[model samples]
Target: MTSPYNNKENITDKSSDVVWHNATVTSEQRAEQKKQKPVVLWFTGLSGSGKSTVANAVEAKLMALGKHSYLLDGDNVRHGLNKDLGFSDADRIENIRRIGEVAKLFVDSGSIVLTAFISPFISDRQQVRDLLEHDQFLEVFIDTPLEVCESRDPKGLYKKARSGEIKNFTGISSDYEAPLNPEIHVKTAEFSIEQCAEQIVDALIERKYFSF
Candidate 1:
């Protein structure tokens, strides 16, 4: 069959050389055999919106429930995989791109992965969501207002941004698009960390991401 495009010469079939492996013996298969579904919980919001806090706490809760999980925080990922990237719009997109691939790998490994990133741009966040299967991706918005985030300013980023020391800071120098239809919205402004974490966990439970 030919593609419906004019670039017929560009089409190449490499399907014959593909090899099959019985990775069915891996932990992913084992978990799925146990009827456990791996999920990517993406936390997006402004700085100091308690994204990292809630993600870490959620991971702890999942751990306590005897489930596999991991957390990918913005700062932590930057310290390693994305160390060379700056805060420019291009770098920000690339940063999220790398995280999206990593998160996909984690999901394939049968582990619930939580990502904590400002992910200010709606397009960038949508790109990440597009990498996963339906019901496998959960977008959680840490809906904390800018005023609250600035006041908390746990990392002093707000001060740097305000003083013109930092460039492309979300909610300070850059823009943050609120999620329109997130699977979970934790109003961090009105809730404690524990409460927020519990809310997220409950959503996961309701979604049946795990057996227990």
Candidate 2:
């Protein structure tokens, strides 16, 4: 049987047959109508580092403030859009690439999209960053120490990785490239989830991504 991931033809076909369809209403119009600046809040960190926790909290805050927002989480996506992809390096790259495209659509629609993933590779994260405009992509690094992440181990994934039950596991069998200069870095160990979420909101406000 052929490997599902070995199809290169489908990946390389960017033809002119499909012209870009201009939407009747532009992104700026959508933003103006919604009264908020659209952005992709990409949260990257180790498993159990509170990426999902803090991201959800931030989304809640955004909603309470009447900002339009959506969250794309790792496990949730895997259950559907990325079900075919595995933990292999190539699969991981493709997974992030597809998500970047989806997030770009969300931004075009003028919604603040929060993505919580263990997106371990810096290059992959940078690729997603390049997909958006300069100010539209906010890299929020959940900067928790590896030891702390292992201790938290909410899913017991770290324990499995340590036991060699899970291969290519980030911060264990696989390598995780930390962001050298993320736009926002929240040290989960130093603050409460609400505080971390507020810190992100404060940054967004300070940058004038949205007011009040």
In the range 1-212, model 2's lDDT, one tens digit per residue, is 98645666654564435689887999999999899899999999988899999999999999999999999999999999999999999999989999999999999999999999989899999999999999899999999999999999999999999999999999899888888999999999999998999999999999998886
Regions more than 4 Å wrong, model 2: 1-6, 10-16
Q: lDDT tens string, model 1, 93-186?
A: 9899999999988887888889999998889888988998887899999999899999999989999999999988889788888999999999
Model 2's lDDT to the true fold? 0.93
Pairs with steric clashes in candidate 1: none
Provide the lDDT at 197 for model 1. 94
Clashes of each: 0, 0
lDDT of predicted model 1? 0.88
Best by TM-score: 2
TM-score of 2: 0.95
List runs of model 1 lying over 4 Å from the truth: 1-28, 33-35
Q: Give the Å shift of residue 203 in candidate 2.
A: 0.6
